[model samples]
Target chain A: MSKLNDWVEASPERERIYAQEKLIVDTAEEIWEAMDKLEVSKAQLAASLGKSKAFVSQILTGSRNMTLRTLADIASSLGKKVCVRLLDAHESNAWQSVDAVLISRRVAGFAEVEVSNDPRWSNVIPLHKESCKAA
Target chain B: MAYSLRIAHAVENISRNLLVNLYINSSQPMDEYHSGSSLTIWLWEGAEASWAEAEVGVMEAHQAQFRARLARLAEFGRLRVPDHMNSEGDGIHAVKGNTGLRAYGWFDRVSGRRAFIISHVVLKKKQKLDPADLAKASARKDSYRLSKESK
Candidate 1:
């Protein structure tokens, strides 16, 4: 086993902590990206949320614990909505690849397709154009 | 004077051998097609030892935070946030954690694969990196280049 694997398996607590940290970092990145797209500054976000600029800075830096309520508030302040999904361990990294495949299939005129067996492309079903038109 | 010169050469050889043996910590498949830009991460054995030391000294939460940041870098090729990583000029960059843990390294392209080879690790005590640390990392990068050229 590699040293990284050993470090990962050293303690279950480490994994749990890592999960929390990843969520915080990912959420912070998302907020930062949204702010950049919306042309919102830290001071502006703070004004929208009626909070202090330092609080927003803390959120961006992942130095403060961001609860679901805070996340929703931040998203609303930025004129965006929060999306939360619980994905399986395998799907977490593979979902993007599956999405890309579905998009390519649509572009290639394969309106309807089913992907299975392959874990990377698993659990994705592309909707047919007829079905979309009917809807 | 000749004997002293020989002793200096022997010491250099021992240090060179030690530097040549690196303890890598990457989980990416080198040849796999990744949807995201994937870069392999490499750490010198001494740097790894320093990381282990930092892991032992910090809180478990901080250690996990550091690992997760590294995992993101390996998975995504780059950290999206500048706060997490940014170039320090002169080809040296740093991977930073919220708790002030940092790994100083540079990017390399080897065999058509991009890699981030960590030359050193530090638990930074200041908001800005010390110039001495940057110089050491830069010197190590030069040594790495020389070693590769000799090969």
Candidate 2:
């Protein structure tokens, strides 16, 4: 195990703190991404929410505790929606790997269908295209 | 040369060598995810010592947040949030938090693999980062580079 893993696993308190901080950082990062995508500056966001620029800065910098209402408000201001997901410990770490596998499978299926429809593969798998069409 | 000046130079050399040694010995990949694309995050010994000196709960929380940010940088190849992480020019970047904790480092190709090597950590008391702190971090970075090139 890495030193970080060992440190986190050494105590339940440490793990709890780590999990909590991770969520906060993740949520803050999502909001930042949304703001960037929408070209919304912190000052603009603060103005739209009728709050001070410092308040918006505090929320983005993880200085203030953000409530669900605050998150909803920010999302509404940015014309975005809030999404919350709860994953088990195992799934939390491996979600990307699982998603990558699922994505690769979907892409392979599409490639197979495309290949089957190609004239080069018509003689090799004459019935494959018909089966794909029916599916 | 004056005795005091000679002694000062010797002490400086010793400290620089010690820092370089610490940089070499403390290099480790942060295990935040199982992805193969993760970049190695090297925590300098000084940074670890400073982090260790923090209050237990605060230390754990900051370390967690820092690790998460590094993981995101590793996975995504860049962190879009300038508030969380930003380049400090000349290839040096800072991973900062609202709690006034900042870890300064630079990216370099280590052993032919890209890595973000943390040179030092500082807890800022002022609203603006003291130029001295950045200079110290930059010095450490230069020392690390010189040592690497010599090897």
Candidate 3:
């Protein structure tokens, strides 16, 4: 294995970061899926949200930090609302391996976990539990 | 269970088996059981959702075909791959779909399961998987094995 792979395979911290980032990326992908289902183009969505197309593109592609306000705006534009759910460890299969860290993160509150192509230093933003609490 | 976890579990099993230092993870290297044909597949971590995105219909068709293959294996004691879609010699069974989409996986019977266990799912865009993808899949299989050994 390469140095990077060896590091990732060995590092619990890196794996936790990877899992958290997967959640964010999956969430962004879900937003893209909603747009696909609604047949809304990025430009159309941007126009409706009073934002630039690039902004919408960036957020949905997981390129930019997805703010709560932004998530709600996008959802409302699509006749939806931003919904967050706390999936139990068993309920979250992809997350099961990294459950220990995620459980800590969730209890610490909802937060942004970034995944860059480089596994070295993805930023971990503090999560505000109030913003992401399940309704 | 999510398909991702299912893949993870299968890889874990394959890795543990290989760690006894007796098995190989490849298309041509592994042995098949007497009851059913075995196959190998590869899946990149975190890419499961995208499997249904582009080429939706083709993806659905391929998924349906995969289901049918599993059904046949369960009912008829055989799962045959069409020549155009299946390839050998890499130690990984490569299944090619129309529109340049491809998947890598394998089937083998495991303990506690009557049907063959389908493991390692690597989604590819080119007809041929990049060498890195193959290496990654192999490394992952080994990682899974290591995890089990430590446990």
Candidate 4:
């Protein structure tokens, strides 16, 4: 839905991809459990990556200034993966059912999220997986 | 151009309270403050989900756009605004910045200094196909791999 005046466009695919960064970072930390969640602050990530703290800070901020090599290492260190696929603008909405965000929520029972246009809203019902009870 | 936004009333006291039915915002400050006619609405105040997860390219674009807007407002010298302190039509006296749209004459909306996710915004009224408006459109956009909401 292109709004001539909205001044904002939500590429369901891109937005969905963007949403994935935080989730990946957070979950990857969980996989690091015993070592104090690694506490890999920008300082640590920088030391390990042999880059400037400021540079690491920019990367952590998800700025456009990242190199694929850096991103790959971050992904590798975090035990995650990165994939890039191009799709047309019109095809974004149809992707609703398969987006990783909604998929993860469904699997985790975090909440059932709906990404829609007409009313245009997103909702996550925090709940326990077993009983489907709100947390 | 005049700008406006629709946001949680709690935006006024975000540090003190939780917003109803929304993701936990990363505590990003709305950046600058200014004035308006009736109430003191904020600009860049609604960086919500999109901007937080926006790519760096998008943020740069927004920054460029914001700078252009500010230059225009600076030309007028004193922006007319409704004053909260005065009963008879005193507002924020100000200029506009590319990022500070809708945030006329006001102050202190940005939250949390460290670990902030940068964001640019769009008011509901001024919304358009402009990529800058959605730069930080959603906090949900910029999730680290495998990270879930507020994990």
Candidates in order have lDDT scores of 0.65, 0.63, 0.44, 0.32
Q: Look at candidate 1 and tell me the lDDT of residue B77.
A: 63
Every candidate's CA RMSD: 14.4, 15.8, 16.9, 18.8
Q: TM-score for the second chain in candidate 3?
A: 0.45
lDDT of 1 at B138: 94
lDDT of 1 at A127: 30
User: Pick by lDDT: which candidate is best?
Assistant: 1
Best TM-score among the predictions, by candidate number: 1
Q: List the residue pairs that clash in candidate 2.
A: none
Candidate 4 fnat reads: 0.00
Candidate 2 has a DockQ of 0.15
lDDT comparison, 1 vs 4, better candidate: 1
Q: Sorted on TM-score, highest at the top, how do the candidates line up?
A: 1, 2, 3, 4
- Each prediction's TM-score versus the true structure: 0.69, 0.65, 0.36, 0.30
Give the range of the ten consecutive residues with the poorest summed lDDT in model 1 chain B: B24-33
Could you give the CAPRI-style class of model 1? incorrect
Off by over 4 Å in 4: A2-5, A8-38, A62-64, A93-135, B1-60, B63-151
